[model samples]
Target: MTEVGNRHPHGTPCWVSLLARGVEATQEFYGRLFGWEFHPGPSSLGTYVRASLNGKNVAGIGELPRDRPLPIAWTTYFAADDADKTAELVRGCGGTVGVGPLDADDAGRLAIALDPLGAVFGIWQAVHHRGIETSGEPGSPVWNELVTRETSMVATFYSLVFGFETQHVVSTDFDYLTLQLDGRPVGGIHGVGRGLPRDRGAHWMAYFEVADTDAAARQVVQLGGSVLRAPRDSAYGRVATVTDPEGAVFTVIRTEPLPA
Candidate 1:
């Protein structure tokens, strides 16, 4: 069971998933990283596997289309009251609908979509499935963000569809827009070629929680994953950017402890 009824001004973000190249490899990597266990599950879609951390439902990883070219990446899902309606809103907001408001067995209705700037995300109408319960913990999702050249359009499109109002600083020189769900910062949008190398296209990156950012970064290198950026302290947490052996980008964050 998932933690339910957590809503925001826009809508509740319920589920998160990933499409992996070597399903077994991803399963092993993430399971080792996050202490999660994977098992075959009954899905309305083709084949689905539920990922559990310490025996609790945490996230999911699925196989991509073997018949076509695709990238291995994590996909974040925002909770929707009606996935089909949200898909319409996405199109109306100038975002493209890549997939469907199709059924995923009894899990819920889902659709793959791109923001106006082409960053991808998903919509989930959870029935039996709620969403990711433990985020900001080692092996679970800590954060998700998107980068785009059209930062203004990204703000307007998401605001129009999901009602997310972005938070940004005017004088900072960086075009960083924080995705606020019901006033709480959920994700962010940044300009391309800023704080990263050129040729890095617009994409969504998920951050996993870790107990020690330094140790995790070392482990990433030891395990053959490339470290794009070493651990650095931010106002939110200490983080490091990394790419998996397959070249999928992600983050590892260790948040600062709150005052007692």
Candidate 2:
């Protein structure tokens, strides 16, 4: 297990990609939610924006082409020393790499990989961009959690590749294992088993910390994002499930109070 304060064996978590049908609407919605500042990314990737709040990159937003059958969603990215190596590790462990070990100019090299149960994630090799520099604080991303049916395999795969330690202990009644690196909880993994809707397949879901759950949910609806679940009290905090304007699903939880 990586002891407390150990540097991330792979690299820091960087760039998060979000899919939005209404790019302009999402830009405004999250702008209100996180107080994020945005700027255009490379001109070739139209409608993709790099998001920062308080001068730190926290997430990203872009338009999803309607031609594709893909669902609207937020896919998180983690930096790797070698994108190719990370892709190999994913395949060796029974996951599928849907996209490339391809380069994105001076920005980085990247590939999209899905776990055996089909939760997609991005492997990033940073060139110009590193990652969200500040986290676990109010108004920034406090945590990311992946939920799936193959809990132990998902845990083992990441542990072997990234050196993340799986804490047998959980944070809330719903949490499975605390995903730790250098001894602090960076994210978590949860087992869906028979708990979720019967037709819902195993997938990765992320949680963004918010100041108020009710307000955020309302903004989601206002911005064209659908509400899958209403705000409710959980053992950990008040949480709600929502889909972005593009149909990418995620959750938000109110942990600490927002600035008044």
Top candidate when judged by TM-score against the true structure:
1
- For each candidate, the alpha-carbon lDDT, in order, equals 0.76, 0.74
Clashing pairs in 2: 5-182, 6-182, 14-131, 21-246, 72-247, 72-248, 73-248
In the range 12-127, model 2's lDDT, one tens digit per residue, is: 45557887778887888778766788987655456788888778777877777788766677787777878899899889888899989986656667788887777788888776
Q: Which stretches of candidate 2 lie over 4 Å from their true place?
A: 1-12, 43-46, 136-138, 170-175, 197-200, 256-260
Query: What stretches of model 1 exceed 4 Å from their correct place?
Result: 1-10, 193-200, 258-260
TM agreement with the true structure for every prediction: 0.89, 0.84
Shift in Å, residue 121, candidate 2 = 0.5
In candidate 1, position 155 carries an lDDT of: 79
